[model samples]
Target: MTGPRFTALAQSLPATVPFVGPEAQERAAHRPFAARLGANENGFGPSPKAIAAMAAAAGEAWKYGDPENHDLRAALAAEHGCRPENIIVGEGIDGLLGYLVRLTVEPGDRVVTSEGAYPTFNFHVAGYGGTLVKVPYRGDHEDPEALLAKAAEVAPKLLYIANPDNPMGSHHPGAAMAEMVARVPEGTLLILDEAYVELAPAGTAAPVDPDDPRVIRMRTFSKAHGLAGARVGYAIGAAPLIAAFDKVRNHFGMSRISQAGALAALGDKTWAAYMHRLVAASRDSLAEIARANGLTALPSATNFVAIDCGADGAFARRVLTELTAAGIFVRMPGVAPLDRCIRVSCGPEAELAAFAAALPGALARARQG
Candidate 1:
């Protein structure tokens, strides 16, 4: 007898994933990494209050989380100066992106994104059989003008951009972003993934009208708030678009403990400054580490730096392999010329030191080969 038939979409899809977690690497290597710098996770970790809040919620996990995401959305609404109806919380931006693609994209629909932007967004678009039209990065940044031009021509179902973009850590100013918002083509929705915006400097987040239906901006507790494991992220958009997610989202998908943790983390305003300082210090630390090794680290507005290895993608690959062999888990870009650099995350002093020690050897070995 034949097994259950797979849908054509499922049958045609490849099995590869966007990211391989460090734990998977640890298992393959048979040893834990001396430093985990890949995946852009916050090595500094969650707020103390969030941890305590999660601990307190552990006993109540038998009950399901609030389906409406009431408390977390209220907190996020206040933080963004919008009403609760303006926000929708989900299991991080990744989950929200999936729901978004399902809500808007369909087979053969055009989706526009910058080449070498966040891969996961592309992954979601692909999963829905949407056609992706990628615009090349103008220099190292996502060129908003090029993206909007492409959108105007393609009139895509969605346009995806990550501020303080991943893999490169470059960001456009708020004014530039606002200008892009003003030019979105009719019937196109701009999905601004601000996963790292909280880690960016002042004026980084574009001040778009929350009631504007053409844009949907998302932020995650996963980054600066250090709640990646808690999987909390919220989107801000027009009320009608925000309500559209209700038809597609997993009503009880968010964990009860994660909700409590995220709410507590949101209330702890002091941690933002502390984490900001830690990230700034660590960025400098990575920069010095790169300079000492005779490399240059790109300017970054987020909690990571992309170090130019001063060679081709092959040389960068060797450097990454050597670093992993040395038990320092780091990642590089998947495509060039971005692949000519390896991305490093901001970590505490100890983890950063481990990377620093391992890097020179990795560089030397990469040079020899």
Candidate 2:
């Protein structure tokens, strides 16, 4: 053969990038975006302590991060009232999801997730040749009862649900989340993606015991901690399942500086609380901007707002195009119905001001088209 043959599954897959990031767009346009609000990145940035710690750790960059992530995992466990055995630190929730998928999913295995939930998670599912059964969102929220019903029927290996969900910014109260966790089908491990939980209102986290084997929770410093660039995340579950990550994860994937930064970020509790306030304030400002523009802003418990464009997906897309063209970067949902809204991430006032300035002209252009 002229070239080495790939696996049948790899050959069958499409060569597609699920997300075309803002940087790619900027490169095409030959200019930077006025407001980088598309990717749900925390514009507030990492805590001062984290930044300082990263700088301090830079001298030690020659050494690899701990394969075991010893001190960091221990701190996380203490924070969550769990033992160190229950946590596994990784590159990010995205990387951890890949490891989890590879560990549990074989060819032809089934997994369940909401239709338009986190695309990265879906990407991992597809990579492993797992059959994904998508449950539609009911009233802009992932339907717990429907997802559980399908899981019970199909008995899939894993089920995913994200609270304070991405793209839509809707959230279920802690009581509902607890109920969903309780209803997970027998033999199914629920993957609760709580990446944005820190920014959510009080009582958003479910009251599940840390040692619960039925569920594994993934969290990150990527959101309210403002450490998106650092790429640190962890999973909490029963000791046995947490231990299983060692079988597939890139043991030394985490950077030494990133580990130090994450540890410092955790130690700076006041910084986390301050970020919560800033994000909440930015959310309100975004909502106000939407309202002023004659759009409906959905309620949010996350660091972003999804503004309903008061029209169909076509109109919303036109508006998004105009916004992007006007030097403001924003993103909309990929699928229909949900695509009738555009998602805007929380940022400092200067960035939001740019967004606010561009929106009206963008709307005018969209209307003309």
Q: Pick the candidate with the highest lDDT.
A: 1
The alpha-carbon lDDT assigned to residue 30 of candidate 1 equals: 96
Over 4 Å off, model 2: none
RMSD of 2: 1.0
Off by over 4 Å in 1: none
Per-candidate local distance difference test: 0.92, 0.92
How do the residues 177-284 of candidate 2 rate in per-residue lDDT, one tens digit apiece?
888878898889999999999999999887778788899999999998888889999999999999999888899899999999999999999999899889999999
**Cα-lDDT of candidate 2:** 0.92
Error of 2 at 260 (Å): 0.5
For each candidate, give its TM-score against the true structure. 0.99, 0.98
State the local distance difference test value for candidate 1: 0.92
* Model 2 weakest 10-residue run by lDDT: 204-213
> Cα lDDT for residue 10, model 1?
87
